[model samples]
Target chain A: MKSLQELEEIRNKTRESVYLRKDRAGIRVVVGMATCGIAAGARPVLLAFLEEIKKRNIKNVTVTQTGCIGVCRLEPMVEVYLPNQEKVTYVNMTPDKVSKIVSDHIVNGQPVMKYTIGVDGR
Target chain B: MEDLSLHILDIVQNSISAMAETIRIAVMEDDTNDRLTVLVEDNGRGMTEETVKKALDPFYTTRTSRRVGLGLSLLGAAAEFCGGSLIINSQPGKGTSIEVWFPMSNIDRPPLGNMTDTIITLIVCNPDIDFIYEHSTPGGKFVFDTRLVRREVQDIPLGEPDILEWIRSYLSEGLNEIRGGA
Candidate 1:
């Protein structure tokens, strides 16, 4: 079993850098996590985003969950909110699509248009 | 949902939606008794007796977005199908607690899939809320309380990548130890 002492060490190692940094306006990635979302496998997609973001050491990006996005068929939906840009809703999300979203949109400020709800015909 | 953990995730979402500040989840697998039980208690806005009664109805929901409220109803059905049961206890302004159990040997009982992912998702998504997760098997028991983690971490947010990774490994390791003994 892992020890809380290790957690303390992690806290120590991470605290300095965290304190040195200024609070900047960051990107927000929200996943739909209602009954429809879970039934359609939103959990993995949400985990994928978290893993991708952590693996790449992307800072200032908050990945969270929302209740529902109104369209039940597009259950596993993801909405990305850039600092000042319009919110981009990505429909029919899967773990496979997380890497590209992280690399293109989150890292390079380019939303993958093909994956957006607009391109998905609502 | 395909598995019990998914049902757990859905049920916890309802608690989060109800503005729960603290939630307790317990999963017990008893080989001697041939039972698998899950208990989730939340310090959220409680419901009236009437609301609790209606909560089991698939067509009943308080949300206006869409008409159907299937989370609790589906879980109740799943429990019944597995020769088990689901019970809800609530008092307005106090809180709510849901207990579900299944016959361990039942072939139809869904597996308790990836709890690590479910827990990680909940913690990361709702960093402010405190979650106490306790899992017990015939061999041993494992308990994880966010309050202790919060105290140890101090100012570091639980959602931080490193912290989240640590939590994931911790839970996986802890759960594996108990399940391995079983």
Candidate 2:
């Protein structure tokens, strides 16, 4: 029932939003949501970030999506692209982990190494 | 097969891949009652009621690429596992609507994964089709649609080199706002 006009407002206003904020350099969280990723539950991971960013009142951190990372079995995977830091890959992600990642990594400047790729602390 | 939410995303994508012109996705969270709901609708090439029933079978597949179609099967499994249910209804010549209900307390419920990639891939692979994605929490709503984006910028193809990057960010920011950005 939504219209094109709503999307137009978005394209116009936010076209320069992210770029303008680049001077501040926010954290970038990319989650895989390919057919494989979706089948593995990437939606919650994305929402987790949305909730955390708002709850913590954090700025500059943006969450996005990516295609198949070639590891379907370990999906719901999240890659944290921190400002000026190496990309950290986290596997088997869930809504719960999203909070930790937000609080520890984005806000506290400490990545949840235990949840990062290959650790599988599950 | 693993997470319910992921399976839900896959089946929804199947509708998009089937050339749905208008796709609707909704996520609702009720913390007070402790529940979440996801619903996806599409006005695309719909299946016969018979086909709709069979599509849920793990071994039934219309695709020639593989032996089976796991999208719906996984969704069925995820829904059942999470103290929830998935209902798929379709009519020949009409469209399909898939609904997933999850008890937010279900420990096994899969995470709500990335949607940005899902929309982008759908946009890139099916340039001809349009997608309307909407996600709403108790607080607000986020929506992304290709048709609207395409209409606004006539000169630039969203898939084009420079525009693609901006388009991607626009989607992320727009979605973030829908979810009540900070």
Best by TM-score: 1
Cα lDDT tens digits for candidate 2, B1-182: 44433455567667765668777777776667777778888897888878888877989977665556677777777778768888888876678888878788888877776557556544544455666777766667766666667887543345432334455676678667756675
Candidate 2 residues A11-61, lDDT tens each? 565566445666897678787866677666676567667657767756577
Worst 10 residues of 1 chain B by lDDT: B173-182
Cα lDDT of model 1 by residue, B98-156, tens digit: 99999999999999999999999999999999999999997699999999999989989
- What value does DockQ give for candidate 1? 0.86
lDDT of 1 at A75: 70
* Whole-model Cα lDDT of every candidate shown, in order: 0.92, 0.69
Best by lDDT: 1
